[model samples]
Target: MTRRVEFQLIEKEITRIDSLVSRGETELSWKSDGVLEYMVELGELVEGLWRRIKSAQMNVGKIKAALDAWTRTPLIARKDRRKDALLSFDERPEKVSRRYGEVERAAEQIHSLLEENKLLFQVGDGMEEPWQRYVAYVDGIVMESLRRAVGCSLGEWMLDVFCYDYC
Candidate 1:
């Protein structure tokens, strides 16, 4: 279905942007001006894609309804319409089912990547510091905002405080 094609296009664009971000990370210093600009540009692109995905999800829902209607309708229509309905019945179901999952995975990946970018700003926590593997910077404005919002300093929150095995 057309929604599947559109979804694939969005997926490709997200992947492209991610690749660019990854390349920049490898090629440029994290504290360099170029890296900051790249991070902002990447953030903007991800936000735009997020908005598009929200709207696209609605469009996909509409297309799914059309597919449902075609499948449920009587087969007494004109030849072309009947042919289309039949073709859609065969192809649309799988695309309709898979597109949602694909979009959801994309959204989750984007969120994770964005969180990683944000995490780069946090430092001196000393708790394994997985974020260290990504980038380095001292001015954690984003982390400060989060700290203000949460009313606590995450850097001081020792990993041992959490009982989860993953932590």
Candidate 2:
């Protein structure tokens, strides 16, 4: 089974075990044998959960490393061209389109990775509110970056249009 499925199963088992223990403590005799067995099973399940958490953490670290690498690589390489040289009209649109495509693809990949491995990001009490907020924050940043890229591209296009028409 996938790690996600395994985690779900383990979580269900832990919840069940907790209810059983609570019932046993409140309703059953102190010397009941069933309580001892449930305690042992609970211990085993806890250990399994711990191991899975560690594995998930490692996977999250690797994903973060990949994201870091992607961020470090420039979407458009500006080193080869002269700083003061303006791109020709024919080249400008193509370069802007290509850069926008690259940014979109990178953003999609980041979103997918986060979506597929969401369980890895959960901390402490496994509340969904925090996770939702984190996702929203990431999405907001991605959208803002895309907005800036498009704005800059439009600005350049406007400048080129004016230069061609009036300069």
Candidate 3:
């Protein structure tokens, strides 16, 4: 559903933010001491959150696909491309139930993070719903990170140009 899609999009945004942060840190590390140091802890936290969101996305995707497959072929054999295994009619419920448990746990982890960090995330108009707010907040974060990265790159290029002209 929408929650699963939001989770996947948020996961992708998290990955993008991490990449931007890593690049920024690497660039600053060569000529800095404390600037990048502070990011280390923040980066770890983001990584931890990303891992949870990723786990949730994977589990949800798997469960959704399995359920859809079962719905389509309620009493027939089907080739489960995700697991690369043949699933008989009798095996659908058991597998779906098992995956549903995993999905619940992962989803709870994500929801917990959202609840704890509600202030850090933006909740604007049309984002009255939890999932909508989450998607908007993560997308906003991704955009902000990209803007910062671009600004940093520009500053670095200007510095190089000035050094070349003077020296």
Q: In lDDT terms, which candidate is top?
A: 2
Clashing pairs in 3: none
Superposed by TM-score, candidate 1 places the C-alpha of residue 155 at a distance from the truth, in angstroms, of 64
Which regions of candidate 2 fall more than 4 Å away from where they truly are? 1-80, 122-128, 147-167
How many collisions between residues are there in candidate 1?
Answer: 0
TM-score order of candidates, top first: 2, 1, 3
Off by over 4 Å in 3: 1-27, 72-127, 130-167
Tens digit of lDDT per residue, candidate 3, span 8-92?
A: 4345456766776786767666467666665776677677665655655564444344334323322323345322233344676
Residue 19, candidate 1: alpha-carbon lDDT: 96
Q: Model-by-model lDDT, in order?
A: 0.45, 0.57, 0.51
Clashes of each: 0, 0, 0
lDDT ranking of the models: 2, 3, 1
TM-score list, all predictions:
0.33, 0.40, 0.32
lDDT of 3 at 106: 43
lDDT of 2: 0.57
The number of the candidate with the highest TM-score is: 2
